[model samples]
Target: MDKELKQLDNTFRKLPQYPTKVIQFGEGNFLRAFIDWQIQQMNKQGLFQGGVAVVQPIDRGMTKVLDEQDDLYTTLLEGKLNGQKVQDHEIIESINETIRPYEDYQSYLDLAKNDDIQFIFSNTTEAGIAFDENDNLTDQPQNSYPGKLTALLYERFKLGKKGFQIIPCELINHNGNTLKEIVLKYAQLWDLGQDFVDWINQENDFYATLVDRIVPGYPKERAADLEKEWNYHDRLIVKAEPFLIFVIEGDKKLEKLLPLKEAGLNVVVTDDMQPYRNRKVSLLNGPHTTMSPIARLAGIDTVGQVMKDPDFYKFINDEMYQEIIPTVALPEQELNDYAEGVKERFENPYVNHELSSIALNSISKFQARLLPTFKRYFAKEKKLPLRITLALASYLKIYAGKADFAPEDTPEVLAEFKELRQKDNYVQATLADEKLWGEDLTQFPGLIDLVKQDLQIIDQQGSRKAVQMINEKED
Candidate 1:
């Protein structure tokens, strides 16, 4: 007989329910594995005495299975840290219940009446904080996440409930601030009145946050075997890396309330999170953005594969230390350690990270993650960075509608690239495109020509040949 995992089961039956002090906006695997996992630790240590009440922000979500299992799930933490294999498991009981506002609008609003709920967390995705002008206050459930939040806050204001500390975990820059802006915009658009607006501005606190963790959700292929061994069938078993960091920018109140740091959790409650944010974005994300399209064009499929190849591996290292790191202003040793961590993450055997998966929306990602470094390097060095330029060239070629590798970009971006491919002086024209890179890249004198030269080599000899040529040049 197969044993099904249940909260009411003997093994998990004794777990106590803490009051719901956190209302999380998304119940995705990331929150379960990263944030809630940390919460479970804090709970076990008796440092935090609260549970998360998850709200499904979208019309469809995983609440059904969550509710079916009585909100019980396992998180398998696996990865390498400092040359040691770290593996562990935890049954996360930090989630008390899930509310899907699309189904139960009244219950969702009624949550605002709960005096104990003091924290609001959300991970609605990159586009979740957008301002939707059409979403009205009267809708049973407002269309956008920000709109829905506005309604909830208004309800809380009307009920004279205490304001909550809002921390949004979206990947966008200044996520909490952005969400607050949109919520306030909705308030004005719907004319929720000046007093409600004052309540929002004065009573509530919105903080910028940064979250890092690689959660490869639902180990479906290996789950049956794991289930057989553990003697419990777990449908929502999430697989994630051991490395987790949550940085929040707030005042002393946050520092005092969040005692996760006291429990040795990787939570940073700081007044200035910009340095930490810069360290992560430049060291970790920059190399990732540069390598993906270039590796894919050179016929490498996964990040692990890219890290294994002698040529590709060297290119990534060279790009990080030579091109990218020079542009960052953080302490050298700190940057080096971060770079090493990036290498470890890339080489993690447990993660089957496809380069193509990272290649999605490559244009936007490169602009955000790599372009600043490229610009900074050029301005400081007074010369072009070869490896990054080559990578940029690879980006253009992959999108030129001629390469064997298919890049995933918006239709408009793809069409623009197709048009650029057909034009005379295509390299010069494309490099000068301000709409794409947010600046005229051609302003850097020799940068355009170097990219043009690389693109020429890639076109004639293929991407692999181009990579070999660059390797030879470096040598």
Candidate 2:
């Protein structure tokens, strides 16, 4: 710790001047390490010639820190690559300026007049694209991300300028379309009229994008070691996984604007990103949701520990290949390859991904990540999926206060779980709750029985023994 004190006053490098062609919302770690780094890579390849002007979506954000350092930051990428451990680092120089809209509303509105700007990239989180009727067109700064964006678009429209290619990186199912819908709703609410609405609908193009990258953000434990290695002090330092893919549902025209693919980056501009989205949600997130509870109940903490455990590992691998893969519409080889990557990511040596972290809001996660595949399996086989139902049972067990870590969820959900814990037929009651799983899961052929059976095994044999038994029984 004393050795780290040697460079406490060291300065970070500054970015080069480039025309701000992109307006970025949310200057968080993921954006800096993924999108900004991609732009820097494109810039380095000379395939793209532009920089980003980050807009502060919320009143309180990292814009002050970003402005202090001339919007410069270092990104560190670490993970396994083809059975070999590797690390990559870059001083991301894609951000030319930062804007705090709350501080200077006029300056924020003036960004629309910048003719060089052609693209707007946003990752204002999943709930950021919501409609708030409280916001007005004449407000200094609007309440929601959609509201702020609407104000900007109206400004650009009144100036008679062409609209931007707005790409939304939110994790919602249809992020771009959702954002557009909310923006249009705001237009209607504020009485912005037909011509302004027409300008928004016709001139601008909103894209649904799936950005996959695990940015753990600011390696606090090893910051001193990193600072010692880099010989600089960067308060905005971000650590990211080596693997990332940006799947964008947009036109061929967007491909020409930002040549991220041309630079050999993992940017896929496709007519349909649903296949990729499904592949990711199922193969990647499904395993995460499934493994967390079972492993946590079995006294496991991190995902790396889960991978090391023979039973938990087998459960994940079997669940993905046997139950989850067939449900996704992607090609066989693609699914298998992605499954391999997900397993690798689960065992990333550098990250300690806590099962407790993934265990938050287990109900919603199970509904979104695993239920579709579970339903599909039921449709195809007319039988319950052994591995998936076990996962569901594991979720119920943990929520029933069978684990060391306290389960996290909405208060309403927690209260319901508390009530369900008192029921005699707990699994049946839980499955019949349509508000929990979106539909009565008990209606599925033999689902309730399967869950009850798994719950019995978990109760008697313990989570570890249950996992081992399930895999061994299948084999």
Candidate 3:
């Protein structure tokens, strides 16, 4: 085994040397496959001369593996485009170095002071932002990523350096705003003075970004085949779908600086990301959240299988297009197109997208993703959206720890449901929990009773009967 600097594929030999101008906060497969892949395209087109310094946001990560490979890895993109099968592999060379925050804190902090590092990117997951009151300003590295970021920013400010443009790729809505708020809180907590706060408010730019791509990370199951395909063993090989969308909400100045359009990527920089956000949450994510538990309980395993099944497919297309899309504010044609794209994404043959995996945080998911449509539909029609409502009930029933037709359900949703079930009243137990729904869902007229009734029906008659009952009922 030749364990040395080698390009397993000839793809890396022609890449140009780019300046290290971006500080990325995650070494996960999604960032490598999605963002790095785009950066590679930019480099190839001579649109960007910037490289990325990858930093592991957590303790245990692939920093060592990336370092061993000299920050080189393969990205396997698999999916369909325009009804044609597509699968392509490319080697990414935009990553110049990798660093771990735990092992070398000063090195991570030093990146902040580097004038060349102009862009800050992060995908620290949904729960990344938090107020850690105990984090000290003088600590080698603050416990939270945001705290560490604040320290770095303060250091940069003290050194009379302009603030870097930050774009957090966290899954939460308005992630960059939330991160900026927390960073400001840390600044106030540590008594860093108003001067630093003013500098942060003026010099820094935090743009909220909505990123969409299905990166399944490492393909351990196909490692042997992948090794043969590339003629070398790669520990950091990432697999992702062909579809990618990056919606960045920022001013025109920042948009000019990014120049993502010049690279021919699906990147949108706009003053209002609300339309794109609505398109994603209502069209794609809402149906996903609605369909997952129902499909799982109906003996379907993966999203592709569900789309292929006549009953489930009709439910998605008809129920989603006819019922759900009507409730949204977008034009009918745009909604229909988005719905069709959603269906295609669901039916993507290369992805195994298990319904059970999407069942996590179903309660919050409903509140944030689907509840608005439900409310709007109810308000306009003066009746419940039966299929969407039924999906909600199915989610509650799924949460009640029923034996799913698929593999054993993860305990995340089941644990919360069990705790809610222990309460004296089911409606009070679940709907009144503001922490889950972000507000009292009980306030909605007839929602609590409807959910309770449908959940009871699901418990007694099973998923199929419950769905049939909803579908057959005359409102």
Candidate 3 deviant stretches above 4 angstroms: 1-17, 82-84, 130-144, 219-223, 356-364, 394-422, 473-475
lDDT for every model?
0.82, 0.84, 0.78
Please estimate how well model 3 matches the true structure, expressed as its whole-model Cα lDDT. 0.78
| lDDT digits (tens) for residues 184-269 of candidate 2 | 99989989999999999999999998888877677777877787787766687888788889999978788888898899888899
Residue-level lDDT tens digits of model 1 in 1-475: 3546433332573457999989999998888987788888888888888999999998988988888777888888788865689887777888888998999999999999999898999987654677777899899898889999999999999998779899998776788888899988998999989998889989999999988887767876788887776667678888888888999988767866767788888888888888888778777777778788777777787788989999888888888888888888988888998898889898888876666656767776777677878889888988887877888898888877667867776555687887888988887888888767767788888877788788888878766777777677752
lDDT digits (tens) for residues 1-475 of candidate 3: 4454344533445686678989998888778987888888988888777899998877888888887777888888889866678888887898988878788888887886688888989976554555678888987778778988898899899899999999998766787898999999998889999999999999999999888887766766786677776777677888888988999988778656877777788998888887788778787778787888887777876778878886667666767766677777779899888888878888887876666656655665677678888888778888777778788777666555555542233244456667887777866677777755667867777888888787778778777777666556554
Q: For model 2, what is the alpha-carbon lDDT of residue 155?
A: 92
Q: Between candidates 1 and 2, which one is better according to TM-score?
A: 1
Q: List the candidate numbers ranked by TM-score, top first.
A: 3, 1, 2
Q: Which residue segments of model 1 deviate by more than 4 Å?
A: 1-14, 82-84, 354-364, 383-462
Candidate with the greatest lDDT versus the true structure: 2
TM-score versus the correct structure, for each prediction: 0.84, 0.82, 0.85
**Which pairs clash in the backbone of model 2?**
none
RMSD of each: 3.9, 4.0, 3.8
Q: Give the TM-score of candidate 1.
A: 0.84
Q: Against the true structure, candidate 1 has what lDDT?
A: 0.82
Ranking of predictions according to lDDT: 2, 1, 3
